[model samples]
Target: MLAGIVSAVLAALVFGGVAAPAQADPLPQLATIGSTLYSFGDASLCAGAIDLALEAAPHHPGHVLAHVTPRGYLGGPCGNQVKLGWVGSAGLQTRDVYVYADAAPGETITTDLWVGTGPAKVMAIAWPIRSTFAEWYLLVP
Candidate 1:
């Protein structure tokens, strides 16, 4: 009888809808402050300084100059004069900015400096080619 009871309990436990323990989500590496986003990969290097600057930007709705780096880039200075565009509910504004290699550390290859109020949508445009570009969204603060 004891063995039968043990078997019955085991069966109930096994067939029941009890779920396993839940898992924790992975932590993000990017550092965000208010409406601004900053990435400082390998905090031990110059990126730390840049990240600090991004964090200190004024918290307001404005047009920002973003620095973007190309993918799979190995080394060297990543600065180039690129045409950038900002799109918001108002309209689209195109301008030029210097895109550097070591801009945003880890999150994405893009970083920004608040220039003025116009639009939140920002991107890097390749001139002449006109076919390739990279984009990022800025939240209004």
Candidate 2:
């Protein structure tokens, strides 16, 4: 049931550029110990509200799950919407984290990200008016 919901949401993003309904799937409670703030683009032109988490994959050994939720934007004309993505070290495979759609203001998009345990750089890019909004580095354990 949960898998189907997740797959459907991912399909919505990967195939069509449409975002999933904000109230779609619910994830299991994993401890959210901390969060990081990020400002992207030249001279910190834009900022985004996002939360990140890294935890050991419940079943996949040597891999970590990165939970990224793009809450919204701080202020100003942050374009029509924003999107999330990541860059990881070489040889570390990644899945589910490649957010390909735009998230509108006040809309929350949570990703079921799985990647090989290592260092990673998460990024938030603004929409139609293309530009990077924010970025942060995470050491996936």
Candidate 3:
């Protein structure tokens, strides 16, 4: 009876330490130079706030605000609301993407966003989302 009890305890202990597979998910962060008014990162919260700075960007295409590695999207904007839907292939390769923006510590640049998922069809169920407010400039690399 004692041996059985010990075995059960050992099994429980082993499983107690077992870990779950890490999921690929989006992340958000803010720069140190960010102003108090400029909104920052939040995994659970979706707050739209802007800041102020000295200069603005020309809104270039090659501009890479951030680089997503695989299977997840970073936190930021894409571009104009009209072009956001056409930027990515809508979960084409099941890869990752990092979305970032350009502005001073406290600046406001606005743009649109395109959100979707895989294990589905070529056509995204969700489409064009024009951001009501933005900082200045951003990209998804």
Best by TM-score: 2
The digit string of per-residue lDDT tens for model 1 on 43-114 reads: 222222121112213333443434343321124223334566657554776765443454333233344544
Residue 54, candidate 2: Cα error in Å is 7.7
**lDDT (10s digit) by residue, model 3, range 1-141:** 999999999999899879776432322222333322222333322333333221111243222122111111224332111111123324332222223332212223333233222111111111123223212222232
Error of 2 at 58 (Å): 6.9
lDDT of 2 at 108: 35
TM-score (all chains, Cα) for each model: 0.34, 0.36, 0.20
Worst 10 residues of 2 by lDDT: 24-33
State the local distance difference test value for candidate 1: 0.40
Model 1: residues >4 Å from true position, as ranges?
1-56, 68-80, 98-119
Give candidate 1's error at residue 84 in angstroms: 0.4
Model 3, residue 116: distance off in Å is 25
Candidate 2 global CA lDDT score: 0.46
Q: Which stretch of 10 consecutive residues in model 1 shows the poorest summed lDDT?
A: 47-56
Q: Each prediction's Cα lDDT score?
A: 0.40, 0.46, 0.28
**Sorted by TM-score, highest first, which candidate order results?**
2, 1, 3
Residue pairs in candidate 1 whose N, alpha carbon or C atoms collide under 3 angstroms: 63-116, 78-101
Winner on lDDT between 2 and 3 is 2
